[model samples]
Target chain A: MRKILDKLGFTNTNTERKTVTFGDASVVSAPGGRGWTWLSVGFFIILWCLASIFEWINPIFWPPIGAVWEQFVFIFTEGYRNFTLLEHIGLSLYRVLMGFFIGCLVGIPLGFALALSRVMNRLFDPIVEFFRPMPPLALIPLVILWLGIGESAKIFLLFLAAVWIMALATRSGALATKISKIHAAYTLNANKKQILFRVILPNALPEIFTGMRVCMGVCWGTVVAAELVAAEAGVGMMIMVASKFLSTDIVVLGIILIGVVAYAIDVVMRYLEAKLIPWRGKS
Target chain B: MSGLSVRDVSMIYNLPNGEDVEALKHLSFELEPGELLTVLGPSGCGKTTLLNILAGFLAPSSGKIDFDGKEVLSPDPQRGMVFQQGALFEWLSVEQNVGFGPKMMGRKPNEIKAIVDKWLSIVGLADFGKKAIYELSGGMQQRVALARCLANEPDLILMDEPLGALDALTREKMQGLILKLWKETGKTIALITHSVEEALILGNRVFIMAPRPGRLIKEYSLPFAEQGLEKNTREIKKQPDFIEVREEILTMIWDMEEEIMGRQEGNNA
Candidate 1:
């Protein structure tokens, strides 16, 4: 057990440690952390391949890696249903972006109002608080009933997923404006409008960006789920259709696509955040 | 007539439990134009409250402040402030931050740019005009704050321990810069600080206050700041006169703090 622990890099080195304290252990010894990420991913793929080849989990349920790859190529070439795979991806992206943008447009201003004014907060606080905790997926039945199973219902669900998060993020952002900054602005001869626009708005951007990133993630998850419940076309619907026919390879392919797309969106959002708000955590 | 005057200022904060805390009591003082007044006190001495009232950020429950022959009801551009830290806008570039005041007052863009350039050079941050505020060091950030305030050409400057966040060496350097600016601009400055050495080095007039129903207890008119302009502050500190005064004020503050601590311990027992 001691040898195993040593091999696992958990050796009892405390006895041999120097008496003097050093700087942060994590920063001092984050050796090859990025390498570990790649190593874990490589190990998982190898294990999956080995399990499939050895028939550890039945092929029908597990679907070999090659089979999933073949399904991906088939869909990429022949398309899913009447639409191309790209088209399905594009359609989902469109819904998410449209819903997300609209949500931001409306919610950001609402959040500013709620943060800046007592009356607005009192009027909207209960409604926002009530709906904020509710999952957008839980609203599917009502949304479908009201807007039907068309694109509007799906977009509405995505919008719901985004709006509350945006509002909350923006409100906190505005509220987080330092008292000194406002006082500084006022003493600099800035009027109320100038203070709001120049000081408060810029101060709130970092928080608003954080909200956008979180809201995007929630909306991405919600869009897929909404599609699964009612849509005729989407990555989620494609997976649903594939599973009905026991085409586990296509189902696996679809799931992979969803994960990949979601990850790609997040990476893009992070890049944009870095470009726009370089002083975010530094300040 | 052209400087700041505080007449009978008092602040009482009501606690949630229905008790009232007298933050500042019957504080009255006058700050003459071009005079540098440094206020020193132990914690809870209401020095901060007094500074806030002077800046017009907080309204005293009673009493009034008059600046330049006008009743000071709110924060005006003519009275600028420098907080200890984090008052500089991180999102703005150094140039933009310095130019903020003039821009807000609807000055022409060329005039604003000129003001920013002049002040940045004066603060020795001329090369850092386009640099983001967060990219600067703590000391550099304070320089930006000073430049920003000066660009407004405020008749008076209020500072709340502006060098408190800096290292000892940096604090000394900033103290020199502040003295130079005070002599050059000749603007009335009221600075609140906890450092006895600092108050002595910076202020032509020093006001020391006591805690618990906070009010002014003593005032000293000193010549160190004027001497500091021509000689090193370190050399001045070594002088017999400076050392004697420093020791006296240190003991004064130390006794007040000990008394407060003793009272708290007695209450607990």
Candidate 2:
């Protein structure tokens, strides 16, 4: 143990106590960024190629990875401009953003109100809980009947997807704040508004951020579902159109596109999480 | 007139199954201005329960607690609490956490900054203002908690085993810090602790309590005074009288713990 500690550069006199350093695992930290990606992607390609050669399945049901790759390249270049994919993607992004914003606008305050006030929690609890478990996809027929097949229908569905998750997250966040902290604030002679904004909001940030991340994922799924219904363009619409003609390559490409886009967005959210909570990974 | 008073306070907590649990049995105590009163007891002796009532987080089943002759119906800024776990917001940097009370009080930016700076320096976190609460060690986090509460400049400071979670060295360091703070601020303090040594070290007058239906068992006045006593904390430990009082209180708590445990076993049987 002494030899290992010496090799690891450990010493005592309580000198150099101000900062502690530890060994880093560069392979774990930066695995996917370098040559490791080639290995993973290569394995995926081999698996896909073997599965495609099976004689039992329809050719269109499981197209070759090469076919899908060819279509992916075509979609990215000449075919994408003519096929209205860009416009569809833009419309989908806009609808999701609008719905997400509106949901947050309502959910954050309602959550605070629910957690802070017993009366509000009692009154809204039943109604919120009733709607909470129902999948937003299940509400589509009614939504279309009420709002029609235009932007409102899609936005409304996305809002339903985002709002409840946000509200529930906020409520839990608010309630979990330590009473000692509140007492500290009160003793400081802080008023009600101050207690809520300064103490409650700041304490609830990490939870709220977590909720927002979850809600964004839900919104992405909701957008796809929304576009699938009576939609002219969007990633989901692209997939829906491809499915009609049994164009397996387009379907595969569309599915990959959605996965890639969502994954990219998730990466951004993770980056923000890291920046916002620098101490998180240390422990 | 006393700076704070607790007159015949009785707190009863109702269990979810509708059973009544007596937390504080008509407990009453008073503190003069700038006085430091430390309350000590065994676990489950309602030491923290009493602190919570004083902080106005819970209402007593009957009786009232007063600060500056005003009844404490609910929590107010005039009686700030430092919790055992520090309870600093993980999201807020040290500067924001310290400034929280003043900000809530609607102090201007300049005023908030000045108070935060002063308290941060007092707690020896002057350079750590931008550091997030989670970035701090348990000791540093508690220091930030102390700074945050002190920045409110409350007439009374209520602490519930504020250094309980810290290691021995940290706890001792914190005991010293509390004495230093009491000397500099001259704020009335009511601290609840399980450690008899801690009670002896920090309090001008130590209030010892018995277990279960937790009632005040004894109050001991120190031979040494609290004012201008920062340098004397370590020296006071060496005082024969201090050790005697600590031993006496320890024996009382040990007896109460045995009695409580026996009673609990009887209920189980």
Candidate 3:
């Protein structure tokens, strides 16, 4: 156990022995953590290949990784349903972007205003709290009924999903700008406008960035659900379409694509958040 | 007429529990231009409350404060303040924080630069102008705070225990630097501290306040601040009068604090 722990970099000769704990699973060390993650994935793939090769599980029911890879290539090359994979990805991205952009544009300004003014916060807080808990999927039928299956209904649904997240984040950020900072600015002869823009806004950027990341994540999810409302193209639509034909491989492919794209977006947002607000919690 | 005049300035706060808490009571004083006045008191003596009133951040419940015979009703560029700790805008670079006062006053860029450079250099943070506030030590930050306040060229500057957070050596050094600046700039300064050494060493006119209904309990005039400029702190402190005065004031404050404790205990009984 000590040797294994030493090998995993969790302990050395100079330090006290300790168990490496990851949630409920305790191990000797975490040098194994990275290896374990890859090992598990590799193990699952090997099992899948063995099962498919031996006809242990019917290929139709549980396709091998090779089959899924082949289907993924096919979808990339021959297109899926009425739209190409690229086109499907692009369309979904555009709708989500548009909705997220609108949410930031409208919600951020409103949020800053709400944060600054107690009266405005009092007035809108109840309404915002009411809508914030609501899922975009729950609003689909009403949105579709009101605006039909056009792009407007879907876009609005995505907007509704994202706006509250961003607005709440922005509100919290602005409201939480340190009271001492405000006092400092005031004592420096800063008027109300200077205090609001210079002191309050810069300090609030980190929280707003956090809000945007959360808002983007929600927008991605909501766009997929919104695509369920009579959309011809989208990764969400591809998943829906493939599942209808029991094309489990295609469904798996679509889900993977969505996950990869969302992960990529999260990486970009994290990078931007760091670059834009380098002093976020440094102070 | 050129200096500040506080007449019968009092503050009364009605607590939520149907109790009237008088933070300050008819505190009247005159601060001559270019003179440094330090108020020394125990905790809860409304030292800070009085500073806040003088800053125009708080309106006196009664009476008035006049700066050059102008009613001081609100915070103005001519009245700058230095807080004890974490008052410097940590997000801003040292230069930005120092220049903030001039920038707010709509001074020309060149003028603001000159003022910022002068004050920053005066506070011995000449090389640290590009550094962030968080990058500085406690002493350096207070130096920056002092420079930031002085940059405004405020007719009067208020400091609330500005060196209270510094180490003893740093605090002593800062005291001398403050005196140098006071002599150089000739700005009226109203400072609050709990240190008898600090109050005696800095103020030509010193006032001590009583706890509870915070009133001016005692006042003194001394040549120590001037002597401090020409002599070493130890030399000045070695004087028999200095020792006697320090002990006298300490005893007064100790007695007041004990009285507060006794009353609390009596209530508990």
Candidate 4:
């Protein structure tokens, strides 16, 4: 918090001062306290509710706030399709997590190798370059044809979206390491392994964390698209069915829920990045 | 051979355009044991190139560097270098920075701690051990860098203008500290500097270099650095012999600079 306040260009005064969260990753441009966020959000909801209640916009176009809230409770109490709301969210999270987990576990090491070794970079560079500009949505038709719209297909899409991010992040992080520090380690009689693990890896972590944040955002954006194939129970599937039936309130609810969850994941990532790489950005 | 020996070393840098620039030309010198030698030169005199070769960062195109009678192949704990700036690991605390060498050599944790403590105190940074390297002032950071190198117990300490970035007062204070450390440790020191006063005050044996295929042009055997251990560097500089040597080296370097300038203009023409 002190780091954030200090970073916001606050000067020390003789008078007492309040701590500010200026650069809170979750809270953008928040000057002093969190009151503005809640107040603004409440204001928006009220405006939305009044417009819906007065029929300023068509109910089919933008459903009433109260209607969306009731649908949320209905989804929880009884079930959406067969499983409850929590289960739908849980199943979606599982697929994203499994693919993202495996992709990172394999891709990060490969990225390290690509950055560290000329041979590995040469071998993998063309492939990463070729696939980099293509979005995961472009592969959906092929994924469905190959994996038959199963859970594997969705997970694979998420993995394909995320793996390249991790690889490139690691490569950049390794490149940003200072040659002077490496030479300092060498003069200390450090072997190749010691320099690689101790000197190179720690310096690479901040960039890797940046990569992870981006990967998670990409995964969330693509999760809904991936689940559009034939997911049994997910927010994406719920939105798809509701839109088809013109259940506009449920569609709004699903979109809002996805956004809220993605924001929550990003906030958690900011906290972890702060903890693991406290030395980041200072040097 | 008992100290460090550089036998007729030369270096050539092949630029991307298929042109070769001679950075160093047949540079030969020896650093006797416990000698404080300062290599003084103009900007393009290849002082850094000489230090890099001595520290085993680069192999000379033509000659050999022998440290304690062994041919230099790569950086070793026995040959420690302090870079001009940003030498210490920014991530490590001062204590960990000093302990890094021993840690890499797989010393026991307690032994590393002991060495860290000893060098930290010697460098007057005992209280700063827990502090991060970035938090220190430039002078303090250089002290930590020196402590870090000395923690490895190197026989030769190569300082590539270690105090070049400091203010005048801090440079003077650090020069005093260098003399004190040289007296205390009896380690062979090869200090590179563009400041003639610094070279005269800290070096018992000084090598003056000329640029454009950099090579040693003159050498001086002086008593000021030895006297600096007991007297003030300012007072030592007041001596007639010290004044004479300063003027002589100053004129030599001025001539070299003019010659290099003429060559540059010629190239332009």
TM-score of chain A of each: 0.89, 0.80, 0.86, 0.87
The models' CA-based lDDT, in order, is: 0.90, 0.81, 0.86, 0.88
Residue-wise C-alpha lDDT for candidate 4, range A49-100, written one tens digit per residue: 7897898988789999889999999999997999899998888888778878
Question: Could you give me the TM-score of model 4 versus the true structure?
Answer: 0.91
Cα displacement (angstroms), candidate 2, residue A97, comes to 2.1
* Candidate ranking (DockQ, best to worst): 1, 4, 3, 2
C-alpha lDDT of candidate 1 relative to the true structure: 0.90
lDDT of 2 by residue, A1-283 (tens): 8655544434332333434335434423532333445558779877888876664357688778778888877776655525555676677888888998999999999999999999999999998898889899999999999999988889999999888988988999889777766766677777778779877886776778898889888899989987777786788888888898899888888888888888887898889987875644232
Q: Tens-digit lDDT track for model 1 on A1-283?
A: 8766545554445433645436647444644335455668889899989987887887678899988888888888999888789988888888999899989998899899999999999999998899999999889999988999999888888888888888999999999999999999999989889888898988999999999999888988888888888677888889888888999888889899999999999999999999998989877
Candidate 4 RMSD to the correct structure: 4.5
Q: Which segments of model 1 are wrong by more than 4 Å?
A: A1-33, A50-57
Which whole-number lDDT from 0 to 100 does residue B186 have in model 4?
Answer: 97
Q: lDDT of model 2 at residue B77? A: 81
**Chain B fold agreement for model 4, TM-score:** 0.97
- DockQ comparison, 1 vs 4, better candidate: 1
lDDT of 1 by residue, B24-109 (tens): 99989888899999999998999999988888889999999999999888899889999888999898899999999998889999
Q: Which ranking of candidates, highest lDDT first?
A: 1, 4, 3, 2
TM-score of chain B of each: 0.99, 0.95, 0.98, 0.97
Select the stronger candidate by TM-score from 2 and 4: 4
Q: Model 2: which docking level applies?
A: medium
True C-alpha contacts between chains kept, each model in order = 0.93, 0.76, 0.58, 0.73
